[model samples]
Target: MSESSIAIPTVYGLRSSGNCYKVQLLLDLLDRPYHWVDTDSSAGATRTPEFLALNPNGKVPLLVLDDERRLAESNAILCYLAEGSSYLPADDWDRARTLQWLFFEQYSHEPYIAVARFVRRWLPEGHERQAEIPRLLERGGNALDVMEDHLGSECYFSGGAFGVADIALYAYTHCAADGGFDLSRWPRVGAWLERVRAQPRFSPMAA
Candidate 1:
């Protein structure tokens, strides 16, 4: 809410989530400056009366524009903020390919891997949910294998260049090890993580 006349967006969410971090990653890369209002996604801060008013879903990674346009969903936020930019591909087929990987990340990847990370890291170690760890490890590994095969042939997840696809994929992939998904088995993916880290204006998700 600064009066500088820079009507950029301000993001709100926890730093650890791939969904939240994806928007941050893009903002940093674009050299866009804005405010950050940290929400305790773990403690149900998103579900509080105030935050839920911003997004009925009570989700993290909500984007509040200078004009007060509130947007939700990490992938959709990335798309909205990256319009007319290189983060989105100019070609029709390439754009579709980017969306393809994003869809995979949410349905095929996040449900298995990110949820595992959340349960393992955020939840208490002795929580009843610990019983689900074994399944998450197995399914998460399978998802990583799929990512490995795809990344072996391309620099980024889409268009062979860094874009929204990379932003979506990198958010979780970089933190997969927290849930016991080892990168050693996927050498190419490991390399891809390094590449993401080396992006010109890259910022750590937890930064």
Candidate 2:
């Protein structure tokens, strides 16, 4: 591609989605410029042929480079965007640690927490998914406990710094209450949320 043909990166995302919000949060924290094409997966935006062509997974928060390269998965996108930045550590072990938490957020944390929020807030009352909330809360609360325990000694998730891992965890954690989680139950995690909010250029997720 010609140098002049390259433009700022474009992110296809849903503003209210924690996964998508993670990308927006990091871009803002880095003060990086990009285009945002709002894609609401809940509204079937991602399932369309065009979006599917971009990401076969049919997920939002897909990053399209100015050169037309596409990347998917929120955590992977964070690592790619944060490369060589403070958000992604230069040290091998630190980077591994960051990846560890990133994996945790996806496997142990987001599945229960984000889904609970979706079931409770997005799905209408009496929906079949509502029955899952109680179990979801149980599992999600365990994730919160793990975070609280981790925060008891460490201030941040990304190798002792405010970085992409924090942003990843924070995206869903701050709004965890919307999933019927009582943040008060995890005091350390609650305090960590405040610390994350205090970071420079920190942007609030859409309501």
Best by TM-score: 2
Tens digit of lDDT per residue, candidate 1, span 1-79?
Answer: 2434335668898987888899899989988887899998778899899898999998888988777778888998887
What local lDDT score does residue 75 receive in model 1, on the 0 to 100 scale? 92
lDDT by residue (tens digit), candidate 2, 145-190: 9999899889999998989999999999999999999999999998
The global C-alpha lDDT for each of the candidates, from Candidate 1 onward, is 0.85, 0.92
Q: What's the C-alpha lDDT at position 100 in model 1? A: 94
Q: For all the candidates, what are their Cα RMSDs to the real structure?
A: 2.7, 2.1
Report how far residue 63 has shifted in candidate 2, in Å. Answer: 0.3
Clash count per candidate: 0, 0
What local lDDT does model 1 show for residue 85?
82
Winning candidate number (lDDT): 2
Q: Which ten contiguous residues of candidate 1 have the minimum total lDDT? A: 1-10
Clashes of 2: 0
lDDT accuracy of residue 124 in candidate 1: 90
